[model samples]
Target: MSLQHFMDTYALKLLQAIFVHLGYVVLCVAIGSAIALVLAVLLTRIPRFSKLIMPFLSILQTIPGIVFIGILYLYTGMRPITVMIALSVYAIFPVLKNAYSGILHVDEKYKEAAKGCGMSSWQTLFYVELPLATPSIFTGIRMTVIYLVSWTVLAAMIGQGGLGEFIYRGVGTNDNRLILMGAVPAAVMAIGLGALLDKLQKKLTPRGIRLQEQSESGQSSGKGGI
Candidate 1:
């Protein structure tokens, strides 16, 4: 078939798949991030809890993507919602763990300053710590989103319907071009989104509190000279 014929036949379905994939990924990321942030905050307050959560998250990470998808499909009887839930579960760990680590690792001096200012625990967390942990949280979000999008193709196996439909159809028909058409676009989207998110993080990251410390030191030296 001509390229035009292929476009005429499959372009709309391809667009639909793109939207479906994007929707699933965004939903998973938003839900996972919220849970991760809350967990991270709780873990920071109780380091022992981090130990408990981290091991479980690590085990979740070990489960293969295909296995997770299949298990959900078997239990949920081949629904798209099952695929979404499975992907969300699989995407949770990195964000949760990283957010916990990031908030906990904020410099002691900043925490001290917040306390000295009589900031309550909640106020210190919202005002002093979260902003400092933005880069790490962004990292976790980026990773989770990328993984969610890439693994969504497996959703097709359960009749959940996405770009993977094309892959499966092409395989059934032994059509190399159709297979490439679906696979290539999905890969491009995953990498493209990952890069865009990384760029966003870099632009948004603060110039570290270390910059403030350096400026203070320089000002003190000039005052001494004066």
Candidate 2:
């Protein structure tokens, strides 16, 4: 199809598909991040359990996206909630792992300092550990958002509606243009959202941590130049 013809034919539909695709991505990330954050915090308090639980979650993460969604659809029927549940579950692993790792790896001296100041466990977590962990947690969130954009395409398999509709339809009919209509937008959306998150990560991370990272990076580069 010619460029003008493709645009004229699909302009409105493409907008709608992008909107639907974006909606699923946002909802999955928000829901997954919240759940993961809570579980990560809890896991920190029970480090032993994480040894078992994290491995189990890692196993689940290895499951193919299509298989996961298919199983959920079979059990839940063809509903939007099915897509949400499947996507959110898939989204949880990265954030959960990163958040747990970040919080766990926080410097012991910081915790000691918080205790010296008479801060309680919860206060220390909120003011010290979580702040220090923000960059790592944000990295997981960025990963989740980008992955979710691509995963949301699977939602169309069960009629949940997204760019996948174009791609899947194109596949059925062997139409490359239709495939591009879905693919190019999804790629752009992923890049755009990832960039936005990069900015947000810098802002959310503690200034001291940022400066420390910059110093370390410079030192590494300087040594490499020797």
Candidate 3:
């Protein structure tokens, strides 16, 4: 069913829901990425912590998103903050794994080079390691944002008012158009946001890497011509 009829009736409400849904996603991603990045950096500095923390986080991630959100709703009474907390926890794992893997997998030679240049531990991390690891880190962020957008629908389950409101209402009423109203915009948002982030990933990637990739592509073309 086309969303036009439903949209015509509730255009303002739907627009508000979209913005609210987006706000939840933004909050969750911002908080999740900050915490994940910090934990990733800490784990890298003390490798043994990864042994314990990684397993714990993996276990937490294993719990279904709805289950965790439901549990939080029971305790917190349908508050938006509870929904945000649940979303943040769900959003954290991708970036955490990416940051840990990205930093840890950085070439040892680069570390040695940084040290040889008299860079301090902190300086080496920020200047040399993070720049090289940026592409991977951005990959994590891209995934997290997309995940959060999908997950934000759950906010409606708690009466916090998001696109999920229409979705759940539509489900209860057996209205296909209402369901599409919620689902279609969400899918579009996720795809559009993912594309934007992909562009950002390229831009944020180190210039050296970008140039090398371009040079390699040129070389490959030259070889093909030969």
Candidate 4:
């Protein structure tokens, strides 16, 4: 197909690819972050468990994506859900590890202060630790999103349609234009989205901790203390 014709014909497919990949990445990050946060919290409460689990998570990260996906496909056998499971699994380690590290690094004095100020354990976490850890956790999540968008191309192997179809089509037919058409757009989308999310992280991240700290501080000053 002519470039213009391809653009016209495949515009929707491209959009679907963009959205599907976007959803895929976002889901992986969300699921990973949720699970990781839970695991990290559990580990924090049980230091001995952190030593056991962190190493296992680190080992999972060491396994190459191809090998991991291959193993999943062998056991789960090439399905859309399997593809998602694989990607989600691969994406979890970074967020989990970072969350654990971030939570651990929260200043002891701050925790003590939060307790001194009458914060409960959960309140201390929500009001202090988690807010401070947002940047680190989000950094790992951002990395996972970028990684998954590119990795989702592998989904085509299982008949999970996306931009990968175009590249596979090109490869099978030896059509250079088709390959370029697919590869270029996918790259542009990943890089562009990653940069945008990075900017968002910077903007949305709290200056120190507690997203509304500046406003809260202002309100406290205005009220002139208890």
lDDT for every model? Answer: 0.84, 0.94, 0.90, 0.80
Better of 1 and 3 by lDDT: 3
Q: State the displacement of the C-alpha of residue 203, model 3, in Å, after optimal TM-score superposition.
A: 2.4
- Write down the worst ten-residue block by lDDT for model 1: 205-214
lDDT of 1 by residue, 60-98 (tens): 889898888877777887787888788878777879877
Lowest lDDT block of 10, candidate 2: 198-207
lDDT (Cα, 0-100) at 151 in candidate 4:
85
**When superposed on Cα atoms, how far off is each prediction in RMSD?**
5.0, 1.5, 2.4, 6.3
> Which of the predicted structures, 1 or 2, would earn the higher TM-score when compared with the native?
2
Off by over 4 Å in 1: 202-226
Global local distance difference test of model 1: 0.84
Model 3, C-alpha of 3: deviation from truth (Å): 8.1
The C-alpha stretches of model 2 lying farther than 4 A from their native spots are 1-5, 224-226
* Candidate 1: residue 190 Cα off by (Å): 1.7
Q: Sort the candidates on TM-score, descending order.
A: 2, 3, 1, 4
lDDT of 3 by residue, 1-226 (tens): 3557656788998899999998998889989999999999899988999999999999999998889999998888878889989999988899999989999999999999999999998898899888888888888989999988888998888899999998999999998877888999899989988999888887788889889779989999999999
- Writing each residue's lDDT as its tens digit, candidate 4 over 1-226 gives 7878978987888778767766777777678778878988888768999888888888888888778778888888867777788888878887887888888898899999999999998898889888888878887777777777788788787777777878888899998877876788788877887898888887877865544667788898989964
* Winner by TM-score: 2
What's the TM-score of each model vs. the native?
Answer: 0.86, 0.95, 0.92, 0.83
Q: How many clashes in candidate 4?
A: 0
Candidate 3 collision pairs: none
User: How does model 1 score by TM-score?
Assistant: 0.86
